[model samples]
Target chain A: MARFKNKNKKAPVRPVKNQPSVDHITGQKIPKSFVFSRGKLPGPLRDLELDLRKLMLPHTALKLKEKKRNKLKDFLNVAGPMGVTHFLMISNPKSIPHLRVARTPQGPTITFEIHEYALAADIARSQARPSCPKELFSNSPLIVLSGFGSGGQHLKLTTIMFQNIFPAIDINTVKLSSCRRIVLLNYNNETKLIDFRHYFIRLQPIGVSQRIRKFVQKHEVPDLRNLQDVSDFVTKVNRASTKSAVRLQEIGPRMTLRLVKIEEGLCSGAVIFSEFGKEADDAHEEEDHED
Target chain B: MAAELQTLEAAAAPASRKRKPKHKKSKNPSKRAKQKASPMAAAKPRQPSKKMKKLFRKRAREYHSDEEDDGDVEREEEPSSGDEEDFDVRDDGSGGSEGDDEEDGRGAQHGITRFVGGCRAFRVAFMKIMKKHLPDDPLGPILSAHKKLVAEKLAEDDAEHKKKGETKKEKQLAAENGHIKPANFLDAKEKFLIGVATKGVVKLFNAVSKAQNAQIGLNPSKSKDTKGVESKIVTCFFSFIHFVVLAKRRKQAFFSELQKKNTQVSNSRNDEKGNVTGWAPLCDSYMLTSSKLKDWDKMAEPAAVVGQEHESSESSDE
Candidate 1:
């Protein structure tokens, strides 16, 4: 009877394959597979940490290749209306059996898994429902990446990687609007090892006044309406808006691995894809419907 | 198209005269004479037709007005505005002076009539004014035009009320009858006239309500100022146009719009016109026709409903 009790206790323990480092900002674990080389990375590759640190700032502009930018545009055309906040990238073959690196018109691509998470605590608070501060939740994450090459082999490694990257998100919830997105981005070996980057794509929710302010700050225009000045202010404003949209389109597909706070969660939100050419239309579809 | 051709001829004739100076500069006297004659030849014959149409319209009005004596055009106001405005665009300009003369005649006419029913008294006072102002107007053509419109409006109202059941139809049909229905002086007639005459309805309503009180003997002699009389005249004149002129115009527009939609004007023709020749008799003819149609429809529907119920009950028993 004593021997049977000892065997039961022994069955529950899990063995560790590899340990990961903790992220300084989020205080979350960083998987070991994220590091490219054995021990320290050689030469200027060491500066990648500084580059990534700089990129993590909330207001930093995104940089992507032309082919990747086009790929990102296609993904955003479908999923941009979802108002998604966080994107989780899974590269480890252990966790995702179907993920593979494949060739496409854009270039070499990788199929991986991404789990979308919403901040339920914040959502509950916004909804005026009483909720515990520490509680965080998500719906069932979806398999969404598309590419080819050895995918299922790293299931164990990828599982740990997903655990380290994402928060302790519970899946049991009745009102989750977060959806699975199948997206493609240009791939390279360097991207496979250190794929996560932070993106700050300016979205449609940003009002015209805010955009005008951003334009003023960028061009150092003291007065918005300049009659004597050679540059037509109206044309400049339009050009600036179009440029921002192009930037957003390019930024949409570049994969990001940054950890953001998930506090508010709601099933219904205001994310109309139609362009509001008339002021009446904007009045009918209010801005902050997610609340 | 005719107006456009006349305008082009008038422009061309002037252009040729101006070109004569240029012809002189070019030393071309024969060319100048030829250009002058060509435009003048085209313009002279076309000018009289426009004038003749105006003359014809005036004669038609005088002839019709001379023939009719009935002044019950109060109910015709709603559907006449659309056509009258278009048909009398030129006449309205000259008719402005005539309207003023009619206004004075209307005030004199209102002083004599003493009807008791609040709305009836108002309608009588209005008809007296319209008659005194437009004495030549037979009031027959407009009255018939209005009857046609009322028939169509009643048809639409019936169709709409049918789905809601019989009680609504009874109430609406009761409202449609002009005689037994009590005074609703501040009604659609007042509303449509007020919209056409002035931008504000509230001011008109207040003035009219005050005048109505005075007419009803609430404060009779106290409200007899020239200002009161002028306001009353204005209301009566607008009410005449509202019921008589405006309704004719609106009926014209209604029929045109219906034709555009490919729906026939259901009340344009009446069976009672076989013996009726003049406008007043035609108005009587229309009233008889529409009332008969309404009575027939009302009687036929209930009998059919009873027959259906009896049939269904018998089938169930079998």
Candidate 2:
């Protein structure tokens, strides 16, 4: 009777041991604990946050909802970039879910969690290198994430990471990187010096994607000027991004979702608005029927 | 007795008529002899010059063997492979003049010969002999007919040259300018010459014998496109497709002729084709590469050979 009672009782939540640490929701591995805790924001980070707030404060009044504004502020505090006007945060954990932000001081910035995905596991899975060494760590060198907007914007974010030296080392004794020796910390803290100065920090220009997205969004009924732009719209559909757009439609309360059904390579189904809730469901049912 | 005397007189009458003509010819026999002698004197044969005699002797010695080889039962079965190459050289008579003309201008006159053993005339003669001896050979007869036409054309050209009294200098000049027509001259009117232009300068070549005279035809012109500035030059080579088309047509004609003849002839022809097709492309590519070499810069100074000592020293340093 005691065993049955104990079985009915739920187990207490505890962190798993020895496994590489990663965020459950974002799948992004938490980096070395350098970001100061809430009540203990250090001088440099405080100064950086203050500078960002000062830089962003004069641009425009914060017109976002109170909840969204608080979230954005918290994110900005962590990632100290200036002039962040809008952002789309991905919540799923299949790949590293990230915030696709525009109107940043450094142009477009994709802030995401750094995951401890392995390059060796990827190479092994691909069977690319026949004689791959057993000692090779399973941490990936590249982290690619993407999301879409109903505003016809395709955001592709690619970040490269490795077991390299953390650049923001806050120590006078470890000023000269070559002079210092690497002391391995347990299982997960092994690192070597890699210069990620030029490539990693800089943003690769989105060019056509950003421009076309802005153009289409600005003119809701897109009257594309050229054949190239028209072709781009027709052919270039980011499948990964469609989920975010669908999510966006589901979330926005006031905005009307104009769902167009595509069937048999033609728009044969009805044009349903979000106001008529059953019609949207009907259109989806028709799509499922076609499938 | 009167009837028999009339019959005898009738027979004697025709005999008497024949005797009367002989009596008349005997009176003017010297006049008839003088008439025949005078005609003979009018067409006096000129004695051949020492050089001409020597050339004839040399030709007899060299080309005579080729003629004898045609009749030779053993040689007829398996022809000398080298002679077919010579036949190709000789068929294009312009090839001879081209070498001479080039040698005159360039002065590197080492390997220039006007006559090879298996010329068109010689081949025709050889074919004639082969046809007479080897009657069963269907190819021999047909090829001989074509060669005979070629020989006739050559003979006509020789006659025309004699009539015009074209001097050696004029002939040489004509050859140098590529004005001389090929030996297998189709018509008196049509002349086909290929011109290769590089950077603004043009070099001409006889279409037929250009491959055979690669040394002359391939060498880049000494004349400059401009006086000072070096121009970016482009050169176009003669398309081997024309030769391929011609060969296809010839093959079709030969096959058609073989169909008319026995299957044995067709089998032998196919065997001959198999032998030729294997090496023909290799020979053509060699000819093309050799002819396409227009780097005349090497003529000024012989390219210095890097010696073993220098190579060893360079390798040791490395």
Candidate 3:
């Protein structure tokens, strides 16, 4: 009876250890001392009170609610001229990676970022072009001539024609760049310096895309302009920048793109005209519907 | 044949057929005939005086001149002038005077031959030869067809030389005189030009903290009213919805919006987004940016749906 009474009073259920809410994918806990229990938090995690201590320049940030009129895309575009690489939007443990390098020879160079959410985003964005006014117009060093014709048969025809030009170009001769070492933590952190011509063909101002667009309508990936276009572009670096064939990064809130660094490229004005032709046709159709 | 005979009659026989010049012999031909007979070896073999010897030599020379020139002329005129009175006759018709006319004719012929071979008449002679060989062949109408072409080629050469001779100083002077300005390269034309001329200042602090938090007003997109210089044609090239995600992070920091707000940190560390969120007056007023973030802010001029881009921007002709 005394033993039973002692069992009932057993020390008020103390947990053997803390199950610390670790990063979702990385089976490890964020160090216990990671959270700085100081000053004032932004009410709660949902309030997103930023740890200004971690920020490179706390004074440079703008508040979201106060600047609701500002589009995230335009903001990052402005940041672009600043050479931003990693625009860490949120630390949602759920965010998955688009492409995950499991392990380098030394083991996974970037592992934790490969979560379900990031993977989905990466997949979705991979299938799409990322820049506006289209990235092709910015005098890119690497140009990719993917026959993005309307249908399968159209694509096949384009590919065959492209193949003829491709061989003469010696695309294999294009030098692929290895690394984009971002020495400066700020600009390099957000911007990716790439060997744009390494993978893409530096085309004449007149190219297959222009020719295709000349005859038929080709749509641009929607809503493409960003702040990166207007700002004062400064080359913040020490050594010569390594040119990567493709660069993947987030510009604004959730905008992502697979940017092929075209050295000299421009989208087809003819394509734009064709697109207008289609638009006019669509408008007529809409008018008929209205009637 | 009859019509052609009539045409020939009407064509009027060549002037050459009407005025052939006649040849006549003088003392030289007579002397030459006598000399051929060995008459110059004086029949009387006397011991001649000095004066007599000189007179004999003169007579011998005269006799030789007539013999040589007259015989040559007669031989040339024999076959071609078989008909009577067709050739040009000296009024005297005497061997001596006619011989003088014959000498004049030979001198005229020599002058013409020499002149024809010079630069001015070389082409004329060549053309004459071509006409004789192919009288009616239009393709070989070298004399008639080549003149215009030759003149044009000469003119072009002259113009080219003149251009080559022009000095660099003249070109510079023309430029300074504003003969031509360089082509305008502005994409948006006038609007872009205006953008370069305009400027603006952006403040970061929420008015209360910095300068009494005066809310910077925005002009309506469709308003025709003049905007402040600060808000002009500003082109924003935002690649992604960067500020939105930052906002989201900021939101995450705010404990009030979460179910677990109680457990959230109390750090109200406001990382200023600098003046990034302020309104920029674009010179074009057409500068646009787009984003796919649905719940976040939309670019005013050219925002689009998740899957669809704005039609105008979709036509990115620029």
Candidate 4:
């Protein structure tokens, strides 16, 4: 009887708790995103996609599988269950890179032609001392959009789309500690290009002597052979009152994007605006003629 | 047989002579004129008049008899072949230069050159390919299926919510009292624009709050600052009053006592600096003699820590 009881024994099951998708304080659906490429991307663009996924962070699927045969509807179908709010799809057709940012289910999709891009590795290689801690991507980046206020309805829609793409921070509830990264989108009205830059926010403590700070932070003892007394090290140079110095260090996959088209649906719809105005209209007319 | 042959030859001779003059006349004109005449000659047999048909039949009979007269046939074929060769060479040379000129002109007009075929041919080819690949709309079925699934899911969720009376009540309460206003009334574009504006406002508010916090510290109330200032003033006034009350005698005694203590401390510090038996030299000797500090140069190597760990363990064993 004891042998039979031992054979039939099973491990106790643990209760699973579901994480809330809605913010309790604001009662708003927390925006999560999926960054994927529709078509096959080249090595550099694939790395850029990975960097973008990192930029989205915590809320985004870091390792989302995308197949060449998968269409927009496949992603849309999956998005409903996963609670994915936005889709960032990159495609390189005719050797021209295009990024489509769309809202899930229904969308006013914005298509941008990537004129130029530099991978994060390139940015890091350029710096003397590059610092990208693993914890840096634990929190999503704060977005600072500039020069998007004055524009047409398409521009306004673009501004809104960019704003909502990232999780909105409630000022009262946001922690200073978690604000570690910033994504700056600077729109050039003259050139009609948007400069996208990602940076790490660093705060240096002021009012401490360099030698003392180095010793405390790194635990490396300074050379005492040159000094007559330890007091000389501390009192040699006295700076002003202590305050935190805020600085932004570039940690990038920089992109120069030109808005090409705005569509009404998710990757398909009525063209609300287009960069190639007359040519696009002519092409549309030709298509209509053919139809 | 010789007499019959002579009769056939005599008949073919006049036809060949007459055709030779006509061919020579055509060749004497420009290449464009020859090209035009050749196509017209080829088309003539398709819809020939009665007189033209009779002439063609006579030419055909002459052609059959001329086959036996190889010399006449060769003579007739040579000129036509030579004309064709000349026409081909000219066409190629002229076409090459014309294509170059057209390319240059179009290249200047448009920054990009279309390496594909002419516009009409390209359009026709593209249409043919599209028709072959896409007989019907491929996306329609996929979109409709997705829509159906989404509708079913929504209906199921509504049914489930109705079954859960508490959840339904909570949802109703949330809809009524939630801070986030429903954006269903606005179109996609308007919603986007409003979202942008709201985000901008929130960013501005957050920036202002951060700046305010940095400037005046974390306290939000103005009354607290005023209260702090009043307390500081009261303390200063009381201190001043106390100082006035004990002014003359206490001030003199405090000054003398402070001067005595300063002199004593200076004397001790001077004595300590001058003394050879002090702890400073001992500390310097200890730091200099320490094996860890002695091997500092060697310790700076990449694998120095591993070496140190090995040495330390060996030393411990010894």
The number of the candidate with the highest lDDT is 4
Model 3 C-alpha lDDT per residue in residues B1-318, reported as the tens digit of each score: 234334333222221222233221224566433423432141122233566446544543453465656535544543233121211232233343222222323322322111111212333443455467556643344444456786677779888888866755554443223111212232352232222211100011111112211222343232211121112211111322455578888886573346224423211211111123422222133123311112234343333322224444555533
Residues B1-318 of candidate 1 have per-residue lDDT tens digits of 334334434323322433344434534556434433442232222222455446534543453475433222322332232322332332433233222222222221222111112223333444465576433632233433256777677778888778678776764544222112112233563233223322222232334445555556665434323333335434544564466677898897786556535522222222223224532222556545553332434433544334345545665566
Candidate 4, A193-228: lDDT as tens digits: 887777777644456567655654454546667889
Predicted candidate 2 versus true structure: per-residue lDDT over B1-318, tens digit per residue: 334334434323322432444335435556534423442242222334566446544543453365654424323322233433443344445333222222211211111122222233444564565566555643344443366777677779888887677676554443223111122322331111001011001111122123323434553332121111112110101122355578899998797566536433223323344356652223446435543232445531222222234544655566
What tens digits encode model 1's per-residue C-alpha lDDT throughout A1-291?
Answer: 455566546665557433223434455433211111112222222233223222221211123112312332343343233322222111222211112221111212222322211122222233322322111111122221222133333322333323332233222221122311111221123334312212122222122244344443343333534466524433344322211110111111123221111111111123222223457335323321211
- Which 10-residue span in candidate 1 chain A carries the lowest summed lDDT? A243-252
The TM-score of predicted model 2 comes to: 0.12
Looking at chain B only, the TM-scores across the models are 0.13, 0.12, 0.17, 0.13
- Candidates' chain A TM-scores: 0.24, 0.17, 0.17, 0.84
List residue ranges in candidate 1 displaced over 4 A: A1-41, A49-163, A166-219, A222-291, B1-318
> DockQ for each of the predicted structures, in order?
0.00, 0.01, 0.01, 0.02
For candidate 2 chain A, the 10 contiguous residues with the lowest summed lDDT are A246-255
Candidate 3: which docking quality band? incorrect
**Model 1 complex DockQ against the native:** 0.00
